[model samples]
Target: MTDDKSTIGQLPDFDTLANSLIEEGVLTVAPSELHGMLSGQLAAGARFDPDTLLRVVAELMDLDILNGENIKLILLELYQTTLAQLQSTEFSLQLLMPDDVHQLEQRADALGGWCSGFLSGFGLYAARHAKLSEEVTETLHDLAQIAQIAAESEAAGDEDEADLMEVYEYVRMAALLVFTECNPEPDDTDEKQPLLH
Candidate 1:
């Protein structure tokens, strides 16, 4: 067996300017910064700004890397996505529905499952450990509020889809972070085996 002192990843700095943009994305943040970040994600002819861009489009494949508990990393991705949406003129954020809300909720639940397993697997002392239950409990309530607004909008048959993906992305990222925390390794080799389960 390997020694119990392995350092997997950094405790991400939430101060990342990118996260600020995404968290602010659901709301209005400093727009110039977002404009620049979005420009960086685009190909040639994109007009945002070179100084503040962020691009690693290749992430979608290994994206399964995020499970549920790497809150900070997820936040970073959320920040980047926020920039992308803000940069897209064709995008709209005011036309969400019950279906979208339900899907987001499912995503949240999946994250919770991963978190539970992670905490169980890590014994609460590993670097990836997260008190996901609390963070998720709090976040879910606020998300419900957003869902209500969306359901009402849907009832009225409106189609704004305004900034919904931003919120959804946050939940998704949060899930990924939690998954990361709970699942420090891709294989089950280092996982602590329980005598009872």
Candidate 2:
């Protein structure tokens, strides 16, 4: 558990984004919200949801929290509380680890590729409501790579496979959210409106 906390903390923030999501060509993400989601303290119900969390993130980006570091005290507080809450759960999510790093990496890579394709629809889908920002689209691609690498099932001794699975679940959920956003389906009765660009 100590190792999991430390490992999670050590993961780097997506700070290399130079241009805003507007520059990314597709605008599915707000750079700031992603920063908070990816970097800052994990909040309750923080799992990526297109209309909810990502939208909040976009607002955060427009508000400039995306660029400013919010990990100083906020993330720490959230982490501790969230950790405690998670630990208190009756049953926790479990991850299974592969015996070999090479095998695990192979699996992660394949998963990542699929995830990347799924995420691409958010910006490119014909019905996606928002035009993807160039920076956010590129960043999400970068995220797909990081998520793939992070999905490696084998890690240093004492690292739990279950932890990795949990992390991967988060990654998958985020990717799916982006995909759905890009390719949203309209109501059965509502008039057709095209948001896809």
Candidate 3:
């Protein structure tokens, strides 16, 4: 756990990961979407070894040329940092998205993409498990609705900004909820409990 906490400090920023993917001509997924996908996987108990990690990234990015060392490094860092955040007791998970410099619509689009990616990743594993609680199902439904969100008007105003911030916080907490539900901590008996059955 301490090691995982230390690794959080090495997490790269959104722009750095986005730029690296852009440099490699990998635009199939945005940085926010990628982070969401990784979080979903971790929450659903999808542990990745090195080969599995590379394969999953290549598949998600639709990349045939994944041999680039720089891209690999950036992706590995993202994976480690995301897993650490999900496992931490501090509730430190952060969604990757455009900063305030970007237009409201652009940020909203990224959020939609992130939710879409999360559903895809989580479904890949959760489908096999079955029997999710009603709360989890409702959360999934909410996230699906949020995936369709867009800027309602052309000119964004202060009220719109406030609404977006509220939505962002909702999404952040939602991810943590899913993670906690899927990966409960071990008890003193040391028996691993089944998740969400």
Question: Candidate 3: minimum summed lDDT over ten consecutive residues — where?
Answer: 188-197
TM-score of 3: 0.85
Name the better of 2 and 3 by TM-score: 3
Give candidates' CA RMSD values in order: 18.1, 18.3, 4.3
lDDT of 1 by residue, 89-152 (tens): 4332111112343444443333233223222222322323234467644543543454345334
Could you arrange the candidates by lDDT from highest to lowest? 3, 2, 1
lDDT tens digits, residue span 84-106, model 3? 77777887887788889988888
List pairs with backbone clashes in candidate 3: none
State each model's CA lDDT, in order.
Answer: 0.32, 0.37, 0.77
Task: After the best TM-score superposition of candidate 1, give how far the Cα of residue 171 lies from its true spot, in angstroms.
Answer: 2.7
lDDT of 2: 0.37
lDDT of 3: 0.77
Candidate 1's TM-score reads 0.25
What number of clashing residue pairs does each candidate have, in the order they appear?
A: 22, 17, 0
